[model samples]
Target: MFYMSTASGIIFLLILFRMDLGKYCDSTSRTAKAFANPLRVKDFWVLMTLPRFWAFGLFMTGVCGIYAVYDQQFPVYFSSFYPNPEDGIRAYGYLNSSQVFVEALCMLFAPWLVSRIGAKNGLILTGTIMFVRILGSGVAVDVWVIASCKMLHALEVPILLVSAFKYIAGNFDSRLSSTIYLVGFQAAQSLTAMFLAPVAGYGYDHIGFSSVYVLMAGVVGVCLLISCLTLRSESSRTPCSTVPDHAPSPPATTAVV
Candidate 1:
């Protein structure tokens, strides 16, 4: 199903590119160039050396790790609080439904919110929200309290996703947008889950969900500090085309006899 859906989206994009719609996507040629030769090791090395890349990549990694834990364990934790297993399941569904509705409403407001506080600040706000949600879930005894914390997901999703895209576009070369998203965000999330899932599973088996959550909250708190120190300030951002000026220039090519 996922493959089919992705194929369909690709086909749709192809059709758009053929039409007049693709004209708006000025960075498409740059994207084509980046992937035009995957065998180019130099390009990959250059990307790795950029401070912004690692800074944002680590932020994505940590936040994504927390998100993975919440998705897998929160339902189980939520269910445990009820008198009956079936009641817990039903209540979790209802709470999740409310969150879906709230997500829709919050998506409409995200643009305004990001505009007022810049994308970097928006990211900080979302990270702080996740910290509160994870810490609150771990310490609270009441089901209602945890449920309230879960509702923050509605606000967190829209803000985090939109701000991340804005942050990358505003701070990186426009042509590299697709490459940055794939490596910095998508790959970072996948890597975090791959390495952290087993540790979290072990923690749950030995220590329990609350302890795992508290540990995850600490990881996110550390990531927030890294983000604050590393992310480019909004006032200092230049045009995407010029953002690469801060990166160290490639060493002058040496002539090999």
Candidate 2:
């Protein structure tokens, strides 16, 4: 159940950003780049240089990590806490339905927000929203508070996605823009989950969910600090496309000198 929800959640969230991979996204991007590689697209570089992209990517890593970290455990935790596990599951579904509605609004608002304020600034604003939503629940530990946090999920996960694409679209017409942008997000989700989840799970098994919440809150707060520092002073005029992904592959050697 947890796995299905997460996989589907990412799908729904991405759709809520108001774009599609389409049937031939990969084929199309590759074909377009056959003549002039996306690296040669001037706007692609312009978008890449914006500090907001990195900031957006960074805070999103934390945001995704929070959601991913608990996916394997949250429903179980709720079930144990509630007198009726069935009731809890039903409630979780209803909460997700509300979030879907909010996500639809965000699909419209997010682009406007990006256009008016720019992707970097837009992300900073949204990150604050995510922080408040997460941090507000720290003092309270109950199903209702947890459910309230789900409402924030609409913005926390989806807006950053919307912002990332807005920056890509605004600055780049290169075929590789969407591929590169989405790949960066996937890499972010993968890396933190690989390293942090186990340690977090250990904390949960030994201590409790509250400790895990404290740890996640601290992580989000630190990420927000990094976002503020890195996201400003960047624009399509000055992009910073330094995604936290693996380095590009080396070119093939023709022959030994």
Candidate 3:
């Protein structure tokens, strides 16, 4: 793990060194207005006032919390059901490998799915699937059943992630896109995981794995409900007008990277 981390860091630094900032921004004069002072608090507050942003934040938090609990507790849950620890480990390894394969396939189709259903609807679909996956995790009868649930769960990863980036790109101004995306998607999820991990551990210890999953499913269900009520359709919401017509277009592709 340490070696992998070190190699990843080295690769990232190499990529950074090779990147051309000029391609992203033509000239310092044109870029001056785009570089807003981070210390200015008003803009951040203004973005926070949007209802859609709050919905997205809540959705991210719930989904991430569900994922964290599943990732951290699944081994314990699986082990309890099996007679031997080695059998449990082997089953889990198979499940993990299946998830990786499913995720790869999902990545290939995610863009087309998002484009067909629209971002809000795509999120709703993924959220529904996630809820079902978590519920199944709690009650699945066999290792194969649990593996199937994991495969369904894996589909959400690419769909939710891609839809989120598309939603951010379509709704926010170019200047605010990165900030809103990071805060609503990444930071909110991180914060949720931080708070949820301990609570999840406690629940697992006291109530058993099934009960923990039931609780997590309830939380994710509420988030999906909130998203359904609060998130507006793309046609219904106004796009940001501040973005320059000539500004680099938002990314149209989605990949694991």
Record all residue pairs in model 1 with backbone atoms less than 3 Å apart, i.e. clashing. Answer: none
Winner of 2 and 3 under lDDT: 3
**Residue-pair clashes per candidate, as listed?**
0, 6, 0
Best model number under TM-score: 3
lDDT of 3: 0.78
* Candidate 1 off by > 4 Å: 1-44, 242-257
TM-score for each prediction? Answer: 0.80, 0.66, 0.81
lDDT of 2 by residue, 11-96 (tens): 99889797754644564354433433334455456556665555556766876556566555765665554788888787777778
Superposition error at 18 for model 1 (Å)? 10
- Residue-level lDDT of model 3, residues 167-235, one tens digit each, is 877776656777887898888877877888898888888997888898788888888898888876788
lDDT of 2: 0.65
Off by over 4 Å in 3: 1-9, 24-40, 241-257
